[model samples]
Target: MPRHNSTEKRAARLVQEITGEPYTVCLNAVRARSLAPLAARGVPRNVLDEVEDELEDAYGLILDLPAGAAPGPVAFREPPVAGGRAVVRGEEP
Candidate 1:
C-alpha cells in the first residue's frame, strides 16, 4: 500500500473514473489548464490592433471615441427614406 494518498491523487482518480480516461491523462489535463492563460496572453491585444487598423481605413470620424481606443464605431443613421424607398446617393427623393 502507498504511504501517501494526497488530494491531487484523489482528484485525478475521480476525473479518470468520470471521464473513462487514464489516470496520467487526467493529471496532465490539470497541468495544461494552469499554463493556458500565460500562453494566450497576447491574443486580445492582437485582435484589437487588427480591428483598429481596419476601422481607421474606413470611417474618418468615429464620434465619442475614447482617448486611446480603436475607432470601432463604423455605423451611422441615414435619413429615413420617404415611402420606405431606398435612398440612393446624389439623387433627390
Candidate 2:
C-alpha cells in the first residue's frame, strides 16, 4: 500500500505528467525510488534490496516472461524486442 503523503503524491503526479502512465503505476514508481536513498542513509541493505527488487519488478524494470505469462515471477533482465503499437485509450481509431 502506498502512503497518502503529500510529497509522494506530488512525485507521483509529476511521474504521471511526464510518462502519461496510470496513477497507480506512477505511485508504484515513486515508492520504488526510495530504496536507494534509504540504503544510502544506513538502513538495512538486505531487506531493502529484497523489497526494492519486488517493487522494481512490479513497475520499474521490465522482465521477459513466457508467452501468456501473467508477470508472476521476476528476474532482472532486459525485455525482448517485440513490435506493437501502444494504442492510447482516448485516441480515435
Candidate 3:
C-alpha cells in the first residue's frame, strides 16, 4: 500500500491543479490498484477510465520487451583514478 503523508497530499493537490482534475479524482488516481481503487475513491467514471488508459500506456513502456531478452549494459564512464583515490573532476569549490 502507498504511504499517506502531508507530502503526498500536497503532491496530489498539485497534480490536480496542473491537470485540471478534481482533488478527489487525483487522490483516486494515486490510489489506483488495477484501476478499481479509483472507482471506489470517488473519481468520475469517465475520468477514471481515461486515467486508466494513460497509466496502461505508460506501464506498457516500462516492460516493452519480454523477459529473457539480454538487456544492454548500463552506460557510464569511470571517473579518473589517481593513486587509488577518485579525482575530483567537477568544478572546484
**Over 4 Å off in model 3, which ranges?**
1-3, 33-93
Q: Write the per-residue lDDT of candidate 2 for residues 4-85, one digit (tens) a residue.
A: 6766666565544433345676565465553333333232333334444544454453212224323212223222224321
State how far residue 35 of model 1 sits from its true place (Å): 11
lDDT of 3 by residue, 1-93 (tens): 657655446545543443344567655545433334334433343443444455445433111222333322222223324423222232323
**C-alpha local distance difference test of each model:** 0.34, 0.41, 0.40
Model 2 pairs whose backbones collide: none
What is candidate 1's CA lDDT for residue 91? Answer: 20
lDDT of 2 at 30: 61
- Candidate 1 vs candidate 3: the lDDT winner is 3
**What is the Cα-based lDDT of residue 84 in candidate 2?**
25
In the predicted model 3, the residue pairs found to clash are none
Best by TM-score: 2
